[model samples]
Target: MIFTGKGFRFGDNVDTDQILPSQYLVLPSIKEMSKHAMEPLLKDFSDKFKSGDILVADHNFGCGSSREQAPAVLKELGVQVIIAKDFARIFFRNCINIGILLIELKEADDFQDGDVISIDTVKSIIINKNKTYTFTPLSNFLKNIISKGGLVNYFSAKK
Candidate 1:
């Protein structure tokens, strides 16, 4: 499992509401709320973001609320993965539950918006230009869940 995309950078302590505001959560579905993703932080996020783009952030990304809407909306927006210094425990689990990859890399500061980055999961390294940062490798169980597009899909496939 590898992910590659242009990075979209954010600061520390980005919460669930900021990713997909609480008001949008009242909307019909994740697809509907996805249009408002990162709206509070960047008004033009939905308009400018492209599919497959990666989100890079500082420590404690997704620091508030365990609402699955956050990651669900992000997945709807085509965010395949997010790389951050660290993550809120519940948010980290939520991301994986919904099939988005989350990587922990303490040197996240080196990235800039639009910088091209590629993540090699098997190697546990994130590459940017000529620089590379190593991360803790994911367990095969976790990799299988993500590769199958989340828990539901993983279970369904076995039947």
Candidate 2:
């Protein structure tokens, strides 16, 4: 997916707690969970995102406890893409496992807040205004998983 909009910039070490506040965990549905995503970073984050908007963040995102709900909450909220330097192991896998497009930027500092970006997942390229940087594309296996709406669907389709 190509993203061309102002970024909602966040800093390093943005933990799962910040993404999904514990107070909201009492609820079960992802729709309910989304109300609290990025609670600690932006006071009005829930209302701030547009359908095609991208979340730009620093290194080591989703570093707290293992809560699959974190990325699920993001997906339900229509966060099409996430660009970060590095991601916590569980969180990274959880995101891909659930079909939330997550991109790892080798040079996280290449873009800044409000810099328009376009991510061509097919080409594994990240374009910022006039420049483009390409990385290894996602394997076809992963693509199939994403296209089928996560692992469960992918597996069910195989049967």
Candidate 3:
């Protein structure tokens, strides 16, 4: 799928707790927890974030506990994709499981907060301003999973 959105820049090692603080994990649902996404770093992140926005960060983007709520909260907050230098292994899989596209790019600095970006998955490139960054495209199986809105949806459709 192709995605176009404004970038929300963040730094390195943004752990899961920072994404959705542990305290807020007590909340009943993803929607409730999403209201506090990036609260520790950007207090008004969710309020300022528009649907289909993108998150760009440095290495170890998701570096804490394997709290599935983290990615879920981001998706709930309308994050269409995340571009990071690298990701915590579990965090990477969790995002895919939840259908949030994750792109690995060592040159994420070009994406400043509020910069308009376009991700062409079919072409495996990200365009920000006049520059273009390329990444390996996810395999067709994973793409199918994401296209169906996550693993559960993918299997459900098969049935």
Candidate 4:
């Protein structure tokens, strides 16, 4: 699978609350929840995103809470992928469970916000301008789940 988009940047240790504050958690639907995504960290964040945009972040992205709503809100906001130096484990799993793609790259700092980039998950490459970076490819199992649009859809297709 490959994804291409302009980047949206964030720093290290961005937690669930920064992604979506608890105040908005009680809101109904992913659409309502998404309105507040990154509200605290980047006011009017929802207004800045376009469909198919990419999120780039430093290490420990998604550092607090095991809230599934975090990734869910991002997905609802049309963030196609997140490339971070590293991820908080539970958040990583939650992202996969909900069909949002996350990639780890120790050299994540190489790219800046709004850079047009393309990711070739099959080749494990990230292309930005004339530069290229590599990342560990997702396993076939994980790829299958993402392709089917998350675990629920993956299982539903099987049945």
Best by TM-score: 4
Stretch of 10 with least lDDT, candidate 2: 1-10
lDDT of 2 at 92: 83
lDDT of 1 by residue, 33-131 (tens): 888999989897987788888999998999889899898878877888899999999998888878888888888989999999998877888899889
Angstrom error of the Cα, residue 58, model 2: value is: 1.8
lDDT of the structure predicted as candidate 4: 0.90
TM-score of 4: 0.94
Full candidate order by TM-score, most accurate first = 4, 3, 1, 2
Candidate 2 accuracy as TM-score: 0.90
- Model 1 clash pairs are none
Greater TM-score among 1 and 3 belongs to 3
By summed lDDT, which 10 consecutive residues of candidate 1 come out lowest? 137-146
Q: TM-scores of the models, in the given order? A: 0.92, 0.90, 0.93, 0.94
Clash number for every model? 0, 0, 0, 0
Q: What is the lDDT of residue 144 in candidate 1?
A: 85
Pick out the ten consecutive residues of candidate 4 with the lowest summed lDDT: 129-138
